[model samples]
Target: MSTLNSSFGSRFGLEYLPTSFMVRMGKREMMVCRDFRKRFYAVNPIMECDTGVQAGHLEVLLFRRWLLILSKSKAH
Candidate 1:
């Protein structure tokens, strides 16, 4: 997908979601802190749109970490 075409349209039901590339990036910025080397200094837990047919070690780690993040959705 083009970075320029970065947002979800209202036609897509997921428009309510903040998962567009830019939005994810914004959230990542709000939560993640970096050091001089741009390594993780502090960060609130967040998940990524991981893609693979089979789970790798890192995928398992992400899965476990994602489980720690609680979802408190009020939308029904």
Candidate 2:
């Protein structure tokens, strides 16, 4: 396996390591990977607007909300 330093060095055509751009990542720094299984229609490069996916997301959010409300009411 190619090390991070070697890959980056080779890309720049440099034989040795680069002193700059070398920074450590924090332990708590999370890499949040979004679920891309569902393909949503994109109106623009920044915006996605798929009716089916939107509906499903809404349905799931609503169902969870209702369940929480019901559980709280039952506990009272």
Candidate 3:
């Protein structure tokens, strides 16, 4: 995807798993997850329109050196 269409910290090549989980190297606090999710939805509009997907549910967790993103459904 083009840089303009990419999410924040895209230069790091965020790691997303098959289990609706994502890991990245950053210092993101829980309070920022909502804002982050908003930006994400903005870039990937399909997530918002797809009825079969539960894109609004996003959880951010901090585990030592990794920042984890957990969602109800897998995202490309």
Candidate 4:
């Protein structure tokens, strides 16, 4: 895997237009989730969306979790 795939990499999401360049994140020292969302949807550049979870896989995982909870509640 390359640097872009790692947490140390400079990956970001292009979900929407960035209203501001950077926004405060942390409570103490201060942090931000900057909108270089444009940085990802480049014509020729680095790859990978900022999201870590796969949506399809997440859906299945969530279903399984909900089923587990239901089963536990109805256990006899």
The C-alpha TM-scores of every prediction are 0.16, 0.18, 0.21, 0.15
lDDT of 1 by residue, 20-46 (tens): 222234322111112112224443345
Candidate that scores best on TM-score: 3
In the range 1-76, model 3's lDDT, one tens digit per residue, is 6322213333223333222333333433111222223233333322222221123434333322223433332223
Model 3, clash count?
0
Give the whole-model CA lDDT for all candidates, comma-separated. 0.26, 0.23, 0.29, 0.22
Count of backbone collisions in candidate 4: 1
Which candidate would rank higher by lDDT, 3 or 4?
Answer: 3
Pairs that clash in candidate 1: none
lDDT of 4 by residue, 1-76 (tens): 6321212113223224343122222321111223232233333232222323222111111211110000011111
lDDT ranking from best candidate downward: 3, 1, 2, 4
- Clash count, one per candidate: 0, 0, 0, 1
- Model 1 lDDT on a 0 to 1 scale: 0.26
TM-score of 3: 0.21
The 10 consecutive residues of candidate 4 with the worst lDDT sum are 66-75
* Candidate 4 residue pairs in clash (backbone atoms < 3 Å): 25-31
Report the number of the highest-lDDT candidate: 3
